[model samples]
Target: MNEILILSEDVANMVAAGEVVERPFNVVKELMENSADAGATRISVVVENGGVGMVRVTDNGRGILPDDLPAALQRFATSKIKNADDVYNVKTFGFRGEALAAISSVSDFSIRSCRKDYDGAEIRIKHGGTPSGVPAPAIEGTTVEVRSLFANVPARLKFFKSFSAEEREIAKFVRFFSVINPNIAIELSINGKNTYTATAGMDMTARAVQVTREKDLVYGESEYEGMKLSFVTSLATVQRYRKDMIIVGVNGRVVKDPSIVQAVVTAYHRMIPDGKFPACAVSLHVDPDKVDVNVHPAKTTVKLLDARDIFSFVHHNIKNRLDDAGHDQGVQMRTPDSTEHITSNSYSRPEPDTKYDHQFATQSYDIASEMEVVEYEHRSSAEIVHIPEQSGAESAVRVVGQLFNTVIVCEKDGEALFIDQHVAHERVLYEKFIREAAMTVPSVVMYEPLLINVGEDELAVAEDSKDVFDKFGYEIESFGGESLKVSRVPTDVLNRDIEAQVKGILADMLEERKDTSVDYRALVMSCKAAVKAGDKLEMHEMRRLVSDLFTTDNPYTCPHGRPIVFKQPEEFFLRKFGR
Candidate 1:
């Protein structure tokens, strides 16, 4: 018997469905693309139970003809293209014709359509079964309903996510589409509750505001080589933890083009802090012949003919706009306040005093003339308390003063010890937290919970590290949307910026996910909660910090492997003075 015979048609379609319809979001994407290609002005999408139970898409567009209803479900059948040559110049979104076939192969699918020349018709198919069409009432457009998705493939159904998570993915796709097609009204509902909707006829900026939920935006426009670019980017002040807020689309299709996104981010590198991402909605219109949309199975990844040129164009234009805005602000600053009439370049170099120069020239050169006499009130050597010769805890150390408000200068054993106050405090806190984690650390309940808006990547990291966070006395819960509410924080971080500390911890944890042995959570908490350099400390606080540092098991270095203390021997100073 032949072991590798061709699979049955039903089985073949089920296998192909895996690529196109990976999740509920893909279903929504393919259906919406079809609607857009049909010249849809208004589209509605309704899903129940995270699109596992049902997904219905209704579009008021030029629907399919009654004669073409059956072939719409046939494999490799599509009206978007006629031959192989047309594939190179494809413009429509549903050229592969596999979306509907693959979708119907895995789910119970039905399509109802009405064209101008024929009466409305309905087609029904069950899991790659033969299609059946019936005469129905004349509905102006098409409505595709899919029920019990992945019912035939139980293994795929098991991998479905929570309803809310799935709905969020669908919402993200809808928002991207809405931003790209501002003239098309789109509504999305989950379990009969309207979750997102965008009205038609909004201009680019207005539509971007509605889609990104950002109001402080700067608009940019540039055209080159038949490609037109329009983008609405968040001000440099507006930053997020992840790049998920940056949405890029090419020719009315939302794509995951990394080069374009990198261009925008590189432009803002000098303006924003590191590890921060600015929200942007960039729309690029290029001729369909110059780009290839058939690269990916989902058609969300495209290859541009002039990708490098596009990137350089976007980068320079955004950078120039930001520079112009900064220049205008500088001009405003020098516009002369009510009392001053000084321009930016108003200061001029003054002439030297002639009398002092002439006197210096006439006088004899003497070293004593450069020095000033001083009277000192010296203390007796007997009154000084000398440190012990032993290098143990028995020797006492006295804090002299702080240097540059960053390091603590202490006198010990006839030597000076320069301690990095920040690292000393960090080491102390790290050990303290390690001990507390073994036991139970007290959690301080906040009167008002801190709401942290995180991108999808950060949220995933947080969700994965929930138990670790709970162990460290951080009580975090998803508070709807892309936010997490923190009702309780570690007592060590009570007065600190709880949101920034938590997000920092999450970001570090994500970076260190592969290394399980590292205590990133504790390290992050300690670093964030510790007193930083340049912070003024009272005498008592300095004494207490020094005392705490000595008590730690490892007082010489911080948790991040930075030296906390540096000692200079008296012999070294004597050698410096040529003793």
Candidate 2:
């Protein structure tokens, strides 16, 4: 048997530093959080050499007392909480008191603060040297400067990716902090140059737009039970390529919660392309008692007591806001009355219970008396008419005709619409499958069960996500070690190789937990069932397809993120002809 020894204070702190500060970004995160908790309306962070060389955070918040400045650098010392009971009811960003002690252990650290009507004081420490306080300028805030991070531990410094990489992480964390804490103004300086800043007056929506440099955005808010959620999300038209932009904050503290991320992504589901992600900053305000933020070493992870309720709340709120954005995201189209275009624009948008007679023919009339045709003689046929698909549908809108045997051209109000036939159908069928299946898609039993080979981790995912697979329209079970038994498959996917798709579903489920995600079972089914490009269509077919498309949840894009409808502004034709 081995004997145990109590580690010295320096060694214990260095060990704890590993968990509290993994990289330069983490140091920035901790300091930024402390600034916010200090009630600083204005905070500034300066980083150099990817935070390995230096990090200085200054905030215009309540300054620490001269007496408390020294103790603030010691482990297990925090004024945010006084007793064990205070841990459960923490409302501040920092309560553990481990940040300063852990951070100062591995770096040259110093803190300066001055309360109102008091002399300013500063404390300094360098790799276990004796800490001492000195007189500082009587500033009404706190400034923490850390230099030579991981300098004491060469091993830690060697593991860093690069200076630029570290700088990016610091910048990323500060951005989230600024947006999440909209009431506070935050500034970031990298490599001696100011790079990013957020205004204290700006709300979450404005902050999000400024930070992302994306103008196409929307705002949503909802309060249910005891929880409140506010969001600044990108419109479907905006294309951010990664899910990393979906930032989540709990009770004003930025956190790493997968549940919240999945909910937000699912809310955008078919609205955006599957491979794309929306840039959303979600602020969740809840009672401190309802959440436990002490779960993670760096205080990044949190466990919500009512996680499921919060998920639904976040998902439904974002979903409803997007739904209200309408089919064209506020694009205005007035009824067209131009010469040579179709007439009788008297169609009313259908009511939920209203049924349309698909069998009826479209109305038409001669445009000779309405207006004289401009001699379009100068332009060639190629210049004047591009092939879309054939057009039909209502006299309410003019089906200008088809283009390239693949797209449908139509004029509505003042805009000329280009609709993709294949994507239009895909979007339609996708909505149908989702609506019909509700929670679980109907699976078809196979004559013979398929045997699939999988690793232990995948087998666990297959078993755990059996219900998710069911939602994806599959009935799968464990066939034993390194293998899975699939008895049935979604009716839409019967023709595709069940074995290959099953493996794919498992791999996907493993990435995102099976409990929260569905493999988008209808995606494959809808794609396979949709019309292909180059398929010729009649005028009535184009019109009908367009009509069906406009009525879908999203007419701007298809299920897989392809644009289903595009518009050429009314000015396009005017400028082209020198009219």
Candidate 3:
């Protein structure tokens, strides 16, 4: 055969399709992005069979003219980027024109759009880069329909997940966009059932209530130069859903810059329990050049020109707001009339379970139950005893230090260990409280039942633990359809934020249950009431920490599977000092 190599345009387009269409969700993402780019006020997405059977996105944005329908389907052709120079100052979400060309190559794709002056027109195209028919007149807005997403690529079909899983992914993506763009109405439906719908032009609190199902009462807001930062941190009673609610942005665009997330976390580092994440959202406005959005394909990640400055800005913004507002994070009370938006099917609570590790054989020892220990007016001064020590070849290497308030350092004979302080405390508390929670416990009053409205999703979790609550000295009852009332509280949580503590308990239940199968609710409550890091500790406190750490089942690590301690080898220290 003569050496001849000329690839067809269809082959090149198919190659490009791989990047634009990775999974069924990508189709919905692209179409939705296009709708937002077109200035659509309302967008709706309908999917069937995880979007493998059918995917359609409708937007009420400025539609394409009849003359532009054919050209819009062409590869590398775009109305988004007029010239190469315009790429740097680009602001729209869908600048890359590869979405349509790529979609058309993999499936039966069609677009129906109408410009302001002209009637809407529909253009249909089949696989292999050929138009099945010409554009025909249609409706007022734009709607794109895609069928058999990977029909032309059978190899890709093998990777599709279960319909429910795919639907979850789609739901998550849609929810994020809906939150990011609160002014634009978004509706999502799966298998002919409505999954999510958000109001157009809603305020930040309204949008937050829609997404998180918690209180949207603005705790505080502040202005810095040209930017304004506002937030409504969860009260102690609200069930926490994340370890850190570190949403960041420059001029309303959500970016995954580590500095931003880190700064926000740092702002509330002292306030939050080790593993619990606070709930808040912050929006910033800045010059585009100062923030680069071209970092990731999904646009979630970004590179800021002045990351340190941005970090400082966010920190100051949060601090100023909190200080000025005099917001009492320690208060366990909830604002009345706060609405919760969650469905029964949004998330469910798990049944009681227990998990035990068999890797290490147990050694019998005398220990008081947590409740018994707490009940004693004065802790007994028991003699300090050291356990059997490891010797010779079998001894494990260890290293240790403190990083952020929640991190502990440990290095074993040679390996490095970084421990999460919060998780470690969680593990320790888990071991202590699980036992206390099983017995009939007495009510220890810290405060009167602080009525707090919880999100429906979180309420499901709280309701699941009614029996556990009764056992742990907590007299909790449903206050109303949307709230929880506490007549009695955990004795250990005296002088603490009762509402935040309860929310932390719910969060702990959800997180640790998947791994340990233990009474995570009790564990969460223990951690919430425990002493946090960053509080200046005396020698006694540090000694107690070390001693308590060693007493645990796995002294080397914390509860969340992160190391609890790290040590630097003497030789390394000597080398550094030039001994």
Give all candidates' CA lDDT scores.
0.77, 0.75, 0.64
lDDT of model number 1: 0.77
**By how many angstroms RMSD does model 1 differ from the true structure?**
13.1
Per residue, candidate 3 scores C-alpha lDDT tens digits across 384-454 of 32333444223332223456655555444454455555556656665655544364333454233467666
Candidate 2 structure quality by residue, lDDT tens digits, 47-76: 999899999999999999998888888899
TM-score of each predicted structure versus truth: 0.71, 0.58, 0.60
State the displacement of the C-alpha of residue 428, model 2, in Å, after optimal TM-score superposition: 38
- Highest-lDDT candidate: 1
> Mind giving the per-residue lDDT tens digits that candidate 1 earns over 1-579?
878889888887888799889998899999999999999999999999889889999999998988888888877899989998888788877599889989999999999999766799999999888888878778778999999999989999878877767877888888888887777999998898887788886666677766665555667788987889887777565666667778888988889999999999998876777888877888898888888888988787999888988899888877776554442221211111212212243322223322211211212222342231111123221222233333553557787778888998787778988999999988987787677645244566666677877655567767766765776677798888668988777665644567767877777665665566657766765676577888987655666677678778888899888999999998998999999
Q: lDDT: which is higher, 1 or 2? A: 1
| Candidate numbers, best TM-score first, in rank order | 1, 3, 2
Residue 515 in candidate 3, Cα distance off native in Å: 9.1
RMSD values, in order shown: 13.1, 22.3, 11.6
lDDT of 2 at 440: 38
Model 3 residue 435 distance off true place after TM-score fit, in angstroms = 21
